[model samples]
Target: MKIAESHPRRRVAVLSTVIAAIMLYLFIQDVFGAVKKQEETEIITERSAWLADWRWEAGTNDLEVVAGGLTSLQVFAAYFDESDSLLLTDKFREAMPRIKQLAEQNELNDLYLTVVNDIKYPNDTDSQKNTSLVTRLVADWESRSRHIDEIIAALETFGFTGAELDYEKIAEEDWPKFAQFIHELDYRLQKKGKSLRVVLEPRAPIERIKLPKGPAYVMMAYNLYGGHSGPGPKADAAFIRKHATRMKKVPGNSYIALSSGGFDWHSGTGKAVGITEKQASELATRSESTPERDKASGSLHFEYNDSDNVKHTVWYADGTTLSQWIDAAKAKGIQNIAIWRLDELGSESLEQLRIQPGYKIE
Candidate 1:
């Protein structure tokens, strides 16, 4: 009886091994086939012309009162990994009404709501998955994207013109494919009278080389000022000019009204004067320049935006002990001044925004 039972088990084990071998062979074949297909379409990305602009200057002049020029303001409500739907959650959803109310009060001209990252649709492709993790991310690319579409549709309920796009970090080699993907997505949005704009990180020059033209703004963020104080703005603007010159439109091929980059600073000059980062950052909450208390003087680069579209830059640091930064800005011939960032600034900063902001867009 024991021999008969063991004999059947041995046969079952042999069958299982055969099936496993066949599956392994099929997977290997599929891998090679995909690699071969990828190689065939490796050279299809198109390049466009570029323009340049920035505010981090060398030896500065008077360009102060760099706040309130924005009739349009964008608060990047980006989501953390796995938190993509946070924008739809209670806090964000609740905040949406308030946000729209604010925009209405300001009479905002344009609104761009980016649903950054891959789609999270239930049927999203495996390419959307991050294979690096053991547990795995819950939402796939298609699913995430679909959620954004759902949110986009719902946003229309608020009676605002909205746009959606994925600003995902993509590989340079896959740029052509990426462009094709975005173009298709944009096509879908156009049907709804909505548009999509792919956001980009300017610091990534290599990836920037692969980006397609259809974005409204370069959306410049990250480190800008105090880049080694060597070559200076005229030269930096030359390289920047290349990036901005060709990007004068969005997917519909319309001319972008304006192009913008920021003029930001770190508090090294503040530290020089022995003020803590926390304190300097706190004081900067108002447009009050830090009294050379170990801080670097800040300025704006409004040179590229063609008068009406640009405003002077505001700054605080140890090098500039000027109490009336507004006066200094007027001295530099800046006609319109604005605070650096609305998010970091408080009511004190907003009070400055109403100060009949100065002189010229020309």
Candidate 2:
């Protein structure tokens, strides 16, 4: 009877061991499967960046580099004529075919015609960010309607997907009318099955003012340092975070626009000129001075002298800097990024733009 009992105990022990092993295998599989699913979700949420502002002055070389990589592109095409009607530049006319071809190749559904508040003179020089024009257009009902009609006609003529209002330097008094104009324009565009995007300056009183719903709003996060200011990075982590927090007040889908270049500030003169990532990098290489990254801004700055022995202080963003800026914005829970004017961007910066988001540039 004792031997029989011992055999039964042995059988029970073996069965218990087999069940535990099976349970362990299932637990491991469940954890790994969940991790895999989470990774896939992250990939889907973290998408590519939206690019814009292919200026005629900048040419189409940068566009050629980006090509199908862009989900949508804003061509800096439309400006105000002498009559305040839409004036398409000659360069715009010449580049439309290439632009359309690129759109076709990329199958882009969001090709926007960026119309700035710039008045182009007969001689082709533009008076940029004219506040008077914003007041005049929005304050007068007829002018605003006519302008919208012209924009619609232009969009239809050029096969553009939508219209982007890059109007800047709006006065505080003009905010109400501007918001009304946006609402009316949005209505018309929706009725016609078109889209609209509005660009807001960093100085715009987002919290104090009321903005219309529907159209996407892009906040200009650069220019923390520019021609208007002394030598500094175009933006820092704190600056981006502050703007991202403020952008929450904006309605609908909002994007934070990041600039890819820096400015060259000449000392004593207090004048600065815009320089692209490639230009800045080449300038540093030529000067034989390595650029030092600012920890707060993740931007590179270096000083060099010209043939005239004039001291020049340069601050700019490269690939790694852009990545850091993107990370800062991401930390604030803002994902949509729009690059300001992709012109002569460095190869490294271009690579950073092309890669999937959430990955750091090392």
Candidate 3:
């Protein structure tokens, strides 16, 4: 359908209008994107400031400050038998007063009485190596219920805010039963005005489990390299971020736990033993070896020779590495960061934490 062509001036006018509209649309989009970015930045800034203020208010210690001012503390106190009876440890009883004082002074809202089956006592060497007993505990409903009742009773008796189920190294086939037990325990605890927090290993299939809305799932994000493994960082940045991403799939709030300790590995036998920062430092000093930081893992390592002329490698996290862990978690939008054990932190590391900027959730 051929028709008379429009005048050249009319055609030019139409083209100009279309071009102007396109430009206007792009301008509005650009403005909106800038505003959104600005809002995100502002939220982050506010959260960081709030965390800093909380740190200032707590003033307990550097580790506590760096760890969000000790809102919660988990105590590894006892182990449960198939009969659901607790075998209390002397170490648990000994540490109670100190933990209580710390809670009172910091006004902490939650105290987790951690119970596990793999360990009969604190620092039990076979704890992580054995999982058969824990697997059995999760399989029986009666045993699980009895354990729940005892946990709630203990929480009440000790004035604990909640109970933390730290049954680790469960067989993959028993994950469903474990998830069910957690749900049941959480239900019971809620009725008593208490809470339940489950400690999941880094490799735990969190997606396969159904957690109650009330309890928080804490992922042990460290141990990427530990005493059981070859000489390496306890946790590298990439390892932490990988777990943090998986943790997001967990329901409700989740925490990223870090190790503040170190490991000593024998280069000759490839056997690694866990050590405290103090112990690592003492060994390094005796051997006259200076610790060097590995930029790739953000961890400090040093090589030293022992009395038998056996060369050894020690890899550990210091103030700088801990800060890097915190930053990695922060970048992943994780709000809570937990140190495996407060006692393991060295004085220097604590001081470093005190001077660093505090972290907070948006």
List TM-score per model, in order: 0.43, 0.84, 0.77
Candidate 1 C-alpha lDDT tens digits along 46-158: 11111101111200111112222333333334232343442332344445555555456555444555444433333433223122211112124564356446546654754
Candidate 3 lDDT trough over 10 residues, lowest sum: 45-54
lDDT of 3 at 96: 64
Candidate topping TM-score: 2
| Model 2 stretches with alpha carbons more than 4 Å out | 1-59, 356-362
Residue by residue across 51-126, what tens digits does model 3's lDDT show? 1111222223333444434556666666743343676656566556655665676566577777766444444543
Model 3 scores a C-alpha lDDT of 0.70
Task: Report the Cα lDDT for residue 26, model 3.
Answer: 100
Instruction: Give the per-residue Cα lDDT of candidate 2 at 242.
Output: 90
Angstrom error at residue 95, model 3: 2.1
The predicted structure with the larger TM-score, 1 or 2, is 2
Model 3 clashing residue pairs (backbone): none
User: What is the Å distance of residue 39 in model 1 from its true position?
Assistant: 47
Whole-model lDDT values for every prediction: 0.36, 0.82, 0.70
C-alpha RMSD for every candidate: 24.4, 5.8, 7.5
Worst 10 residues of 1 by lDDT: 52-61
Model 3, clash count? 0
